[model samples]
Target: MYELKTKENDSSVIEFIEAVENPKKREDAYKLLDIFTETSGYPAKMWGPSIIGFGKYHYKYPTGHEGDAPLVGFSPRKAKISLYFATGDTKREELLQNLGKHTSGKACVYINKIADIDVDVVKALITQSIEFLKETYPDQPE
Candidate 1:
């Protein structure tokens, strides 16, 4: 279990967003903040060191690993924004096709800039990812 150090609260989110030095990156971060808040209908909170997360879920795996994590979140790295989503679901491939310029790992989407991707497509991806996590981790609390 990855223990989140930051409390789930508004001050944390504000402080984290304020730390972004680049104006363009800061603006992108704010845009993401809006998208996540609206999509999840959950207040934004800071998760750990840098993740701006929305909502919460309690997850327990078959191997006995269990903990709470945000339903959706992103970290604005120096080079790109790392967007996280639950992996191992097949349905997300369709959304990826329309996400514009992005790279993917097992469960992360890397966007160099918000302008590089279609905002609507990214929003849909967030929605689908949240749904996928809920379905796969059914015991998780919304």
Candidate 2:
């Protein structure tokens, strides 16, 4: 039984953001909190120690592994801010074209700060991620 490390917790989302050592990261964290919340129409919650997540879905793999996860999230990290979106959504790749300056990973899209990217594009990414997750996991709670 594998454990999901990024489970949602009752921790203070603001406390985690405030603890970010970089003042700019802290500010960007606040900005992202609002963006994710407003775009996803889900309140932000603390996921694990560092992630601020909005919305949620339950997913089961073909191998029988299953867990609940945020529909979209972000973590303000040391080197850059990590934006979490649905991994394999073609819309993700499409939106990233207009996402301004950012780097992509398996699950996270990294950006230096809010100012470095187009906020509207981030909102689109959030929308697409939620829609993709909901459509893919329609049996799961949205």
lDDT of 2: 0.92
The most accurate candidate by TM-score is 2
Which residue pairs in model 1 clash with each other? none
In the order shown, the candidates' Cα RMSDs to the true structure are 2.1, 0.9
Model 2 spans > 4 angstroms off: none
Question: TM-scores, in order shown?
Answer: 0.88, 0.97
Model 1 Cα lDDT, one tens digit per residue, 48-105: 7788888777778788777777878898988889997767777688888888999999
- Residue 100, model 2: lDDT of 96
Worst 10 residues of 2 by lDDT: 133-142
Q: What is each predicted model's overall lDDT from 0 to 1? A: 0.82, 0.92
